[model samples]
Target: MSKRKLRVGLIGGGGIAQAVHIPGWNNLPEAEIVGVADLSEATARKAAAIAGTKEVFTDFHELLKLDLDVVDVCTPNKAHTPAVLAALESGRHVICEKPLAVTTAEVRAMGELADAKELKLMTAQHQRFTQSGVAARAWVDAGKVGEVYHARVRAMRRAWLPPSPGFIDGKLSGGGPCMDIGVHALDLCMWLMDFPTPVRVSGTAKTVFAKGHDMPNLWGEWDRERYSVEDFASGFVHFDNGATMVLEAAWMCHQPDNEELMAQLFGKQGGLAWPEATFSTATNGIFAQGTLTPTTQVPHPHWNEIAAFADCVLNDKLSPVPWTETIKVIGILEAIYASSNTGAEVAVKG
Candidate 1:
């Protein structure tokens, strides 16, 4: 008596695909993963097992031949553009992992293609689905944080460098922590600020501790020879609306905290910070501070993200995290690297 479930095909069966994405799809009763494709047959089989489907393929293009309503791309950062383009051209809605594309141009092309095809395309910015993020957004939207003019964003880890060629290699990962965890806090802050247009950026990306043995990694030893990306990056952004932001990302630092992912916003009326959901302001001419509490916890933010994407696709709703927003995020990141290379403030083209 029920209509058919939305058929899905997965494009890369790596750790993210197997651990969160596939499981997220399995949680949606209105969706069913029909097939999985990975370069490794073993990885494909492992993901297909989780999807409860034996259909597996080594090439994603082969899986695209099937009747699929959606394609979930869990590939490495550099591979996201190609996979997303192929999926959109195949007449399938797409949900891709974050830092959707390394370059703003690549994101624009993919976004334009999806627009022409009239397909739903969402970037997997799972942090937005977190309780803290959701709560902060609500407060900001309610004018609690009025006219935010500046923000401090950080995604620093003491010694949690990812141990993989896909992340360490510049050709694969595009950059370093700036693309990895930095995108998380940056995206959240920008979203809360209603996505200001970044006009210019000055940044520095360096291999301070990654290429040396001074700092030991908590995630175990990685190939220092293959590590071609920056271990630390800092940037300053000026927006069209006169708003400013300070961004910092690092895989390894001399900090005591294991991690310190934060986004602190300063506004005309008040100030707020995330990953803590705390706020400060002057009410009735007196100083006041409070913590924004989550009405409910998101047990699995990735699952909530998947559900939202599927809902938008099935119901003709707007993409919860559209490529338009993602392009802006990528533009800022791209400008950071460009500024670092040229030793000058780089203009971000909208």
Candidate 2:
């Protein structure tokens, strides 16, 4: 007889669950798409039909009553806490999408629960699965880029605001690009540096173009009065080991050139970059710096994280994106928001 299949319950049948999670999991024979739940019954049914999922529920709480091995959270940021808690409480593994939770406190609570239960609470930071990202981190860990001291991550956009209402809402998204796009950069940097305890964070958030009053996003404008968050944000994070990172992100900026997404790391030996770029190093007498040059592209699928998660869940293997490291990334993110709020250096608490 075949070993037991890992039955999964999916939450949020919108774009992410349909495009990323379901498709990736379907490729794995040991995993089965058992059920799906969403706020919108129509969308949920559409996804369920396409994925060949049998049980569908509009109420996520009801879906939690099923016998599931894994709970894949593709819901909004605010809903992540309750959904994950329910899954972990039910003795089911959890895989939450990025921005793990909207607040550091929420993430800490989830981590605490997962810890007490001795369950794997994996956060899907899909950027970690990219070939370029994989190569960069592996090279750094192998001491190829020795003693990385400084770095820069830039995520630029011409105003491609997401479609979901919760995306622009501060209470839901946590912050603008600093959380959406910048979170990937933060994870890459911290993971490369092995998540050194951050000492300080200084930052600024601007409502330059797409404020709550004027909602002219790249896709289109929503109700202006309902817009309740930032459009662009930038910050500098300082780690306890004296390493620093300059981070920049935005939905809209005044600059003329638009940068896709770039991460650069500099160390004692050499530096590495992705998306057709170069980062070189110099370890000479006194002065040293790095250079950016065009390099051959490293192709990777956007859905690699989902496939990896499926494999891990099916085989009962440990996830690559540990919940603790995800917490560290969220801690820095919380600090950045706090720094923006109080106009003071936010101390990264645990």
Candidate 3:
């Protein structure tokens, strides 16, 4: 007798879906992508072919009707709340891409509904599954860096702005680099800090370069008229624990490196930087600094994230990236935008 395979359905057959997500699901022998749904029939068909499934639906509602144990949402930022809520209403576990939703209210609604329905809801923050991320988490958990006081996060690119309406358009994407790449580093930093409650936030968001032809984009040119979102954003956060953080993100910047994605934590006992896994501390009146190597290396963080989610579902365990933690992240981000708009420090409502 063979074990029954988990039936999976995917919503939104876009680039991320075809590139990493479809491959991640296919890598799991115990999981089967039973259907794929997209607004475009051609994209649905293409993703269905990649998933080794003939079932394709132009409407995601039709995909939800399938006997799916899990729903993978790869839709645009604006579509996440509805799709995730609908999937949960249909009695399916859901895993949504980063930023979960644009607003804290939407995230809370989905999270509360999932709790009421006793279904697992996870956010696909893949950076937490990376080799360096895992090592840094373990190191922090072991009390290497005690009493974290402040942190710095950055997700700056020289000129790699995504040339898509789903990203650059404010209506579709909600925010700019703050919502796109900034969420990646911000989430990682908050997770490392064990999800401190953000009490207040002061920020600035500006359309510095996307509107002009001064900076040539590395990813190709985008529509200047359609570019409504900010090209750069920065925020200062105050946590409930009296800890503070500085976050900076940009799609175009005059920086030396092509890109510099970092999250550095400063603590009373030590300081640590992620991706690099470098740490500094004074032991026995001697200064010590070294790079921490992960005991295990994850070649594909997305695949590992999928596997982790699957493991939790199979064993009836909690979501690997629960919504409770996600809400805090979204709250801070929402406040950043609000602060930017009002030109005043706004209270983070979590």
Candidate 4:
């Protein structure tokens, strides 16, 4: 740990902030959470109490006025862009929660602002810090999964639909499982493939069981009338490098697993699967296979993610998860939603 302590201002004192972001920052010896801001004053105060800070504000702009080195944004999907922009403008580096923005355009604007300020802006895609993800990335970087041409990504839940308005409501969430859990697997898979430019997307997003009482939710009951987002989504993507990907995301389904978050890639020379973190290949006409075990185990990936972001900001290192890479992921997802609505393949511009 460095001797200098980073002053961090946290925005959005919600579940993610309480569950991971705040705790992760607290685990860092070189970081001190100085302020917390949320839409609800009580939520802000509660988060501040946990973070060992008295500075709490309902308006994030007020929190920005404080002396801070970085802003950790755990706001909803739609709020990410504005919060990140404000943080950058306040002369602070930023680490924002996943689905950095609902659209590629918003992501582009935020990325541009960060670039102009020469600030470290990282998306909190903590899954990349997991043991399996680390090993998988290392294997891909070693050319073990040579020339990935296709992938299968899944983020499905049997019946665990989130019982929160922020997740079920389209206005707040921007999208359902596709933007929530699906983004996790999709981003990792795309990163593994080195983010090939997406050319087109064909997809479907439907409210199969969320708006009715057919399936019982594992996470308690939610307001069906407020459920404006999709309960299930599937998409196919074509990339510029002649690569392709299939993605599935669902909050409720007839699945054996409570949840299955996975990404499997197929390359010309080999194939690989995540969470499993295993690879298969053939050499000299002899088949070979192996599973990669990570050198280190990160009990809390969010902590490692926060530490990485702070290190980048404090040491002038490149952002571990740059917005440039994130835009491509979001672009594919946005195209998927558009295609679903239009009943035709949608072109991906970003």
lDDT of 2: 0.76
Which is superior by TM-score, 1 or 2?
A: 1
lDDT per residue as tens, model 3, 17-52: 999999999999989999999999999999999999
lDDT of 2 by residue, 1-350 (tens): 87988888998888878887888777667787789999999988988987797788999989888888888898878788988998899988888988888677788898889879877778888777766676666666667677778878777777677756768776666677778887877787777777777778898877777754343456776645555767777778888788898888887776565546777777768877753335565555554444332122434344567667667766668777877788777877778778888999888866
Give the runs in model 3 whose Cα sits over 4 Å from its true position.
none
Give the C-alpha lDDT of model 1: 0.94
Q: In model 3, where is the ten-residue run with the lowest total lDDT?
A: 327-336
TM-score of each: 0.99, 0.90, 0.99, 0.98
Candidate 1 collision pairs: none
Clashes of 3: 0
Kindly state the number of residue pairs that clash in model 2. 0
TM-score, candidate 2, is 0.90
Output the lDDT of residue 199, model 4.
89
Global lDDT of each model?
0.94, 0.76, 0.94, 0.92
The deviation in Å at residue 155 for candidate 2 is 1.6
Question: Deviation in angstroms for 289 in model 2?
Answer: 12
